[model samples]
Target: MIHSVLEFLTDELNTFIKLKVGDPTTTRIYLSGVTNEAGIAIPDQSLGISLINIEEERVNKDQQNRFVNAVGKVEKRNPEIRLNLYVLITANFQNKNPNNSSDDYVEGLKQLSYAISFFQSKNVFTPENSPGLGSFDPNLQKIVVELYSYSFEQLYNFWSVVGAKYLPSVLYKIKTISIQENAVLEQGEPIEQIFTQSQHKS
Candidate 1:
């Protein structure tokens, strides 16, 4: 499910960027880590979408463990675990020329800005509104994207932890990814009535 969401988002962003640049074959955005399995940095002239962190959402958690199934029987299962993912979108565009380094740096920032703009305009996505979203995950109902701001100190610490030089990037908090197991603990008919007896004390 996690992969499905990220893939859909990456594809959407790629399409958006290609249209913005007026090139149908442009593939500027991709789903990848800041570094590869060999710890090599991302390629140049690309935007990488990486999952940096996952935090459980504690508020308004579902407590119901029983629901009516299609067969009209009540089934019990564990509640879904809601999560908020911290997704980092980084731009790694640099001109190889030493004298043109500043210009290339600005280009990276510009690409990053396009990403920010894309999310700013459309922060919420649902299968109904977004075409082909259900193809990725039929169970995925909706996804909300919010810009996550961090202090300079926090940013520095993050880069240090990642063990990579800082690049033009933006962080977004993805809200409410529900993960639940399909194994039912129990099944039974719904209670049709409640029986109680009250007797006067002797």
Candidate 2:
């Protein structure tokens, strides 16, 4: 499920870049990790989408999430596993020198700005919103993209943990990725009003 969502997003972003720069093959989006076939971080210019964190939607635990079966029977299941995906999109520019005339690294910042605008313009995505996906993932119903702000300390800590120098990057919180399995836990009877004693001692 995660793979499908990410793949869809990657394709959409690639399309966006192609349209913006008027060159379909200019840039590429990676699934994070600056690795090659041999698994090594190489300096390259492209967009990297990495999943930084995952959190279950505990607030929806009480809601009964379910799906209709083929036999026309509504099957009640446990609450759907709603997840918030903290995705980091990093622009890896080859040249890091700011003073150089031909610095792709600074170019990375420009690319990052482009991405920010793209998301700002289209913050919400659904199967209907994105027609280019063709046969969109069935499990993916909808997704909301939101910009995540971080403190200076948090930003420094992230790079430190990644064990790499800072790259022009932005973080987005992709919210409410729901995955529901049609597995019924238990059937429950309907609830009725309960009898209670009066506090005034009637």
Give lDDT tens digits, candidate 2, residues 103-189. 576667876777888889998887688764446576676878899999899999988777776777899998888887658854454
Stretches off by above 4 angstroms in model 1 are: 37-40, 97-103, 198-202
What TM-score quantifies how close candidate 2 is to the native fold?
A: 0.77
Off by over 4 Å in 2: 34-43, 65-76, 96-103, 186-202
- In order, candidate lDDTs are 0.87, 0.74
The numbered model that scores best in TM-score is 1
